[model samples]
Target: MVEHQDVSAPARLRVGIDVGGTFTDAVAIDAATLQLVGQAKTPTSHDHPDGVAHGIVTALHQLLDQVGRSARDVVFLAHGTTQATNALLEGDVAPVGLIGIGTGASAVFTKRLAGLRTIEIAPGKHLPVEYAHLRDPHDAAAIGGVLDRFDAAGIRSVVVSEPFSVDVAEGEDLVADAARSRGFLVTAGHEISSLYGLSKRTRTAVLNAVILPRMFATADLVADSIARAGITAPLMVMRCDGGVMSLDEMRRRPLLTVLSGPAAGVAGALMQEKVTDGVFLETGGTSTDISVIRNGRVAVQYTEFGGSSTFLSALDVRAVGVGGGSMVRADLGARSVVGVGPRSAHIAGLPYACFASADDLTGARLSTVAPVPGDPSDYLVLDGPGGRFALTLTCAANALGLVGEQDYARADQEVAALALTPVAEALGLSVRDAAQRVLATGTEPVLDVVRALIKDYRLPEDQVVLVGGGGGAAAVTPFAGHVGELEWRIADHAEVISPIGVALALIREQVERVIPGATDEQILGVRREAEQAVIAQGADPHEVSVDVTVDPQSHTVRAVASGATELRTQDRSSRLSDDDLHRLAARSLRVPPEEAQVLASTAAHRVYGARRRRPWWRLGGGPEHPVRVLDLDGVVRFASPDARVEQGTVGDGTAMLPRAVADLTSYGDGGSRAPALRLLVGPRISDLSGVLDESSLIALARSELEGRDRREDLVAVLERRA
Candidate 1:
């Protein structure tokens, strides 16, 4: 069972941990106060299966110790790791068996997926499979024969895909059932996506299957470490789309977390810096990731995995090979010096000049040499005590005084200047001039990517600002100033912003389907489905809000839902009086006081007098009774007609409420009686169940009001009973 923290309490601590290529960072925050309590960093371990887990545990313990807190004090824990991304990028994926269930085009589709074996069964678009095709004696034998072949080939995971599976998934389901019965890990295309792109959807399912084993192993180690530490807080993993999902959800769809680390940094910039519209630059030791935020939203697009498009939604980010640790080289052949990196000092197993000691720097050479294999750029090399090390852009920045002691990993300005002297001589320039040129060359690619993103997205130039984050943020700030006339700001705790972002991210789920000419009711259904999906993934149901978008021309509908995880506490002392309940029912039913009736009342929910009834013919319509209900405090809520709320009418307070609340009451009701009222206020639904008297109920409501606008926020619910 998932443990829920008491949100009604003053505050609960949340810890965010992010595992990067070079370092693992942790941050602890007081969610109620939105204040940073503590943070820690540890070197990332990559050689062992438990490497990431070790880093996470170390960082988390350090953070807790700094804050003078215990593991038990934590109410929420989230993690963002590059493990999945690294596995995919390094070609460390498991082999998969593709079970194609379509006809004419199935073979061609299967052939397009490299490194996967394919088998085709029945085919056709939306064709109903005969009962004999699934369970008949010969059909079962044929399916078993395919499984046998896959087993012989050592295929452990299978992807079941068919044409039009998004609309009708019976065929895919049949194949999945057969595969699973044979003890194979099965991925169904319909389960992976409801979108109409057959090829992309199939590729997505395959990708999910390929990455499942590695992700499961990593998740197990991390979760076990957290559990052994006696922390009961639910664990969430960051998603590439800049939100979070439960560990179980990530295990089922690990592909969605491919670029989660970069996404988390972008989310951090948005939340920590409070930038509504800006270009986010997350400069890590190895690479710089650039993403644009427009109209207060992170740009998301379908992700391409391993050179193939997948149905996963990810932050639209472009990574450049420029960072603090990029190697500086003199590209004499190109008539200009250049800095190229996606490789850093960490990958090269070399310490920056500023971090190296005199002994380590002994035998350093000023001769022009190509340090990188097969590269034509002549670089300055140092025969260190441990090994030969190349001078990098970080050393140049340190020499130029762009990175101060507080921000620079190593604060040896003298050593940086000494290291650059050799490069200056080789390049025939002054030391300071050489450093400046190196910085400029390293930043050019990053600048181009940022400018292109802004132009492509048509971001508002006047409002746009550049927000820098991550350990290499100092390397990005100079470029931010040089990029056009946009204002620039580096977020507080920029070095660990990704973890902070992971810590504060909300549970999110999105559902997209090709439902052409979808009615409002259909769109709403999709929205409800999305809300339910997120809630199931450990989000609080009452805190979930869904946004639905319908493109009639393309017949595509997308629904996104997000919710907070704070647990509400019930105020057992205050319960509704009989008269108060009657009044609430009357108001909710929109009837006169005398005409209103309370059919039943309970601590969980209440049932009001039936408003409308259907004939016996429509009575057994599925499992739902054909009757209308009223919002009698804890009772059934009447479904309000769907309508879009215009922006700015409710003020910014609504935006600050974690998520938007669905208004069951009309605007004329003074913006009260939201179903999520108790959730937003951190009170239990049963808190209003046992009030002794009308005056007492009024006093109870007033007493529960704690923050600014609390009274105004709950005035309508209180007024109905009063």
Candidate 2:
């Protein structure tokens, strides 16, 4: 165990820990001065799963020594890692226990296994699946039985997903209690989400579960590393949802942390400039990340797992896999530099002889050699596609005697100097500036290649800020020059930026309640339960508030329960316990099986709730119980030929619509009755056709109101109205 001094600095110090595949990097900063106080890099050990933990300890100890401070002096620690990502990509997830309740509850579990994984506990099963279709007492009993079976399997957690829980979470809570009593963990659907779309929510749950184990592992490493460093400071991790939580809270929902790396860079960059709107680019050995920040926040694109196109959101970012060590190859006929990569050279060590042959460029370029000699495919090989293509084209041109030897030699040097230029241009950079950028950055052979393209294509030379990282930053720095007047900046820890970036997340959880379209009293009853649940998460019950907005036509009700904690930092003594935090998070994020039933009940109630009042037309005897409503050109014409169509008439030199349209203003007072659907056929000839399919009817009515002859403007009026 390494020990840190108890010395203190004048400014607050925030630490960033980056766990990479090859090394663990740590950067400590004095927040007030914005000065870096310490930096350490330690080799990663892959064979031992806890290698990152040990590396972190080593790095912290080294950093402490350099900064002359003890762990207790640091105010906050932020870290990032790839453990959760690796676990999901490798499919090492446990079999999840699913509980679904509703008419179609079973379908959710059945679908999980098709593209994902889930073990279902249906209404007939012994255990109460977190989700269930419990219509009555018997349904609850069946769920209890399923919980028993899950207990036998020692299943640690359960997910309850029901379609309409946004209205009623009590049913889910009841079922969850029964399962928990049987020793199973329960996650209720309403607690997990309020958004519609059962499939998307379920997928999100599975992804979270898949990443949980790795997240736990990473958290454990952080804890251990802290202990080893003689640090008593509380460790906190950031969430994708834009908040921070103690380490334990983060482990339960790992998906929230997967994108934390890029998010942190955004946060850091924003903080550095005190302005967030701009297109920021971070280039490294393995990939290039371009993110746009708008209105002091990074835009978010809810990208589907492994999908290409991104939906525009608050933040818009594009990542390309073109970087240093990208393969360069030549297609002699096209006379172009065809670079191919998103792949990279292994960061394990330095380059070897075999890599020499693989890089297609005639000049010597830097590369990493594989530790074990075998198939090149097994190694992260940089394709020489772009370099070779650029070289071939230039060589062919020189051979044809189109240029002098001095010029050819100069172009050859320029080709190597401009390696990344060709690829960057392909990504979005202009041809001429791209090559010039290569020339300005350095005289590397790759830069020369990029320069050749600039001269040939006349690309722009606008100055822009550039950030480079990974194993190849040193190689590309020379060629990625300052665009115009903008200066380029690199992340403090280049190779480990991804891991460090992950440290910028917080723990997040959300729950929704289904409010049935019931009487106002019943709706209020359901909302209270949701408010109670929200308060359990360290919120003051008094601070909780409910938002209600209803749509009577759709028989739908939207209610939001929200509360906020005081803006106080965590208490060192009561920092969250790992087990307890996970339990709370899992509970908050899992959808209950009773969701659909709740939604149905809420929907049903919404319709039934409005029965206290009758529509004006239905008030007396409801058309003598047998009147047929005829669909007259999209108008519901009643059989009573003597019925009067009510329309508000505005008598003026220039008649316009009455201040309020009839549908909107025809209601009776005291909420006693609904307004009648009335249309006033005017004296105009077009009015004889009655309500002309809403669109045309409005046109005719407006035309008559404006004193325009309906015969002359009917078609154009209808088209414009539509």
Candidate 3:
């Protein structure tokens, strides 16, 4: 019997629940120690709209029962579902009314987007002609007229887009105010993206608006289910970017949850395997998702919605319709060929040969082909009764002994072999060869995606590892050898890895602005906004770090704020006090505590303003110079020796901060190797891996920080790495 951890730290319980097409898997872990407590899987409820929620609740209850705990013990609960992805794929979305501002808008507002109605407000670029001409009267009337039309057309959601809105969004804002007054949920184009592509931004806004109603309903159902189970912890939903957001944030921007399930699986592989770089293969019952992890970070790309690209950042994952439950068939067309699916057995409503009943096999011809000693699905042929059915990848792996005995017990190998025999005969091949052929064919699509990611990222072939996850992981292992010399490993709890990823995911918020020639203060304002956004979503305020990048060329600045989920049991006494703040400022400026004045105080930290006196010798032998200094305009976080700091230094002269911070933090208290340093540069925050050594980076940072003018321009923090 497995020993269970004590429930004394009930509030430390973190539960991850993933809802897949076939099953709802749940895992409970001790968040503080990062130890697995218990795990359970329940068949996904597909009977009604509330099926996913029901399945999640069922799985959660089972997990708690196994560990002899209660729902109240869970301090954190995260969910990753296919509900949004399926809704988008199946054309199940709410109708949205789009109010376009500017001339030639009608040309781009075609029938390309499903369930969208368009109305042009006025003609102009930044501000519509009516808004620019009359400020309020004409523009207000125009917006009201559009809203009236949308209401008449039964539109409850609205997407407002205008040309050059990223630069001047007043026109979009005016339309949003009018639409909201008319009781419509509004998605503004500028709010979704700060890029210049109006068409893509408009499409993205429409997608976000249309998915709101359904996603809000789903969120409510999940919240209600958790409430019913006596768990009060904030519920988090995984995002397409491989991080998680609070329920409120998800409801506001459901578009981020698209493809979240696959993203979560990649996150789980990265965390559980502890690998910095690799290709993650998440094979589910219906599909396989492939993603790349480069230099300890999951690769991210703009989200593509229904074949149309959007400006939202999402995990760079490629999914193919081939997995454990994929159907095996012989296409006897112009050219006879053995095919593995883009379709699944569940969709066909046919049981796998291993799970088929004896009565279901009555008319099937049975032949003993290549019987593996104890495996049932291999070496047998059943070509009679119940129409032609064959073993799926899951069954094939079981029959060949590639799957562990524990997993094999879930299906009947005899039944699998019986169903596969006929397909082998049709192809004029032995059962063993046919089984091998089926596995290889299924792996081709996945391998192709893997090869593409490796080639595109120019990943080191020798360092890349293939990580298998999801229920069909066993099916992927058989072909790993054929993919070349890269190492391969399956994640622990591979079947339920997606949910585990969701549970372990950090809270992240990103803010992008197109401010041309922005001042240092304005850049810091945006970074602080991003940090607060993440904190509002349940992240610890002190643990949050903001990464900012400015492109003088495009005049775009993007900030990403991220932090670990705050625990209720965390020590609060260590928070910096007012006295501590004064002392820090004095120490930084080489002055007395009385000389520093508190300029501002936030909930978590304080900012002090001070003046340092420079002697005549330091100022070229003149009189003493009193230089005004912001001193230390930074948050006073609890000092954690193990904390990983992410410092964003701007200004043309501050280019060396990345290298300096990396070198300074590379060693621990006793000079032992501490946490690894990951550096990202450029407006897109491109990884600077292999480009800069520790000493080089340190020298650069020192050079940048040495100048007195650049001191207050850097925003730095010490927090745990996500």
Candidate 4:
């Protein structure tokens, strides 16, 4: 979903809404300044006939009122919903009738997929599926007979699947068209994925079919309500991979919105925080969802639902059961704190002790009792004027001044100390020590995840920053960063980061092909297809950039394209000046302003480098050269310890390709590998980092430069292989 956002400030406002299990949040951002101008929250209306859609509408209206802007002033509107994911978890889904088409071997393959008959969407609830097949896929009479049986059995949705549908989906399409004509919600396998995996593709499509009716109702309800508000801007929906897709696309692939809640937070980090490479931690009351953003894009992978592996690509988010409201577990006998939480104050129906009045904690005593039945009775609670209040991680952080005044989770320090004073006395340590110990224990689990991600992503050690978002972000990230000794900060409008992500997200589409021994032309064809796909969905074609990656083992060619919906800025004064770029690059490199000198420049970007001087104390660390690639807006898009930069025309780059790749390529016990490279032209950055084979790399390079004028600006940054 991360097509690079234009640095130019646009016009008007954009509204974003996020529907959570408990609350629906909406925020308005100034399109020209990207500033969060107004925000509102309303309790989720689950009991209403309209479901969460009603809450979203209410929040959006409240936000508009606060911002004093009419609906027409908004250029975009979108929301990240958890309804589909929650529906599967709660087993609130319609029955599916699968109409598989094929003959002989394909028919047997579809028949053997009996697992679809009883999928455990919840612990005790299962997804009901009825399977029916036809030899003549185009026979409307045969399809009607199958539908008659399904209708009698109370099935409301249908899935059409066939073998080799990726090659030609006519059979599946014919079945789908017949089903739709019969008023049954239809899902076609090839429409879900163009890959050759029949089983996975069918399963994914089946899951989509189950949620089709409910999601369709919500999308239609919202679209109608938005149109009634006089807003003609497209109503987009957040996808699980950090992009915003049109409402029509959502109606077709509602399953794509699964897990978009987490993706929305990281999308905010990518576009709003301008995070090129880092770990983003979004903490709520119960747990913290940790995800990584590399090279300005969110890391995504296929996700699993109810033990079923699907081709649903979503943000790779890992959750830890620890957050601000996490209750502290202690052992008075051992006089040591055991852990932070797997339970939170909200779940226990208790208010945070840090939010208590100082007078309420006066003469307060700590009593150990389990908040729920059949549990350990060592959780601490304060019994005083407040009767019973939970002592949680938020209280501990506030006590130690770890939660800043400006932070959303911040509370009165005096009240916080009073809440933790009992723990301090029980552990026979100072209140400060108690607070620190509690934080260290609480954040340890999250710290483990952070360390693993940093190493796994090969993030630049010196440049990797830890960004915190969500309401409880201050309760965890600050202390976690302190324990890990890394740079950290809460995001702007941290409480509403997810909605902000939804508002600022770009239009994105990814087209993947399984082409074995693919030629350069084939790769380029995929790239063009992806680009055209996003544009067809409302992206500005001229603003689009495509990244093509080929995997030899799977012979999978994936081209991801993204583009801004529109650009409204044209003034040259908004661009960064040379001095401004130098200061920013120098600060990012942790060197003097004078040391970070420009190494290469394109019309859209500049590569800055700083000399490395390992003192006499350090050996084997010399001869290192670090570089930072900065866009015209002063955002550092790429950072590395060693790299080579070159600027030229298309022809010049083609001629120097051999030297460019050879200079940074490495050789050792393993065979030599090509360097990671990127091409920076006017307002576009083509990522060639994922390509390893030189021939493939050159072919891709030629494809990118094919239509460009010979004398156009081109700059390449090649990272040295380690």
Worst lDDT run of 10 residues, candidate 2, spans: 601-610
RMSD of each: 15.2, 20.9, 14.1, 4.1
lDDT string for model 4 (1-722, tens) is 74334446334788889999999999998777677788999998889987887888888889888867778788988899999889888888899998778788778888866568677889888867888888878788898899999989988899988888888878888888888888988999999997878889989998899999999999998887787778898789999999999889989999999899999999998988988889999999889999999988999999887788898888999999998899999998999899888888998899999998988888888888888897788888888887789999999999999888888998999889988998899999999999999999999999999999999888887788899999999999988887899989899889999999999998888888898888877887888899888998888777788888888789999999888787634345767889999999999999989888899887778899988875666444666678899987888998877677888888797787767887777777866677888888767888988777677777777777777778888888887666
TM for every model, in the order presented, reads 0.71, 0.52, 0.70, 0.93
Write down the lDDT of every candidate, Cα atoms only: 0.67, 0.42, 0.65, 0.87
Arranged by lDDT with the best first, the candidates are 4, 1, 3, 2
Clashing pairs in 4: none
lDDT, candidate 2, at 219: 75
TM-score leader: 4
340-457, model 3: which lDDT tens digit per residue?
7766666555556766766667657743322223422232234555653545777666555566544422466566565556656666777667777777777777887888999998
The TM-score of predicted model 2 comes to 0.52
Rank order (by TM-score, best first)? 4, 1, 3, 2
Residue 155 lDDT (model 1):
76
Model 2 C-alpha lDDT per residue in residues 470-515, reported as the tens digit of each score: 4344334423443223334444545544434433322223333333
Native-to-model Cα distance after best TM-score fit, residue 449 in candidate 1, in Å: 0.6
**Residue 502's C-alpha lDDT in candidate 1?**
92
User: Could you tally the backbone clashes for each prediction?
Assistant: 10, 106, 19, 0
Instruction: Name the weakest run of 10 consecutive residues (lDDT summed) in model 1.
Output: 124-133
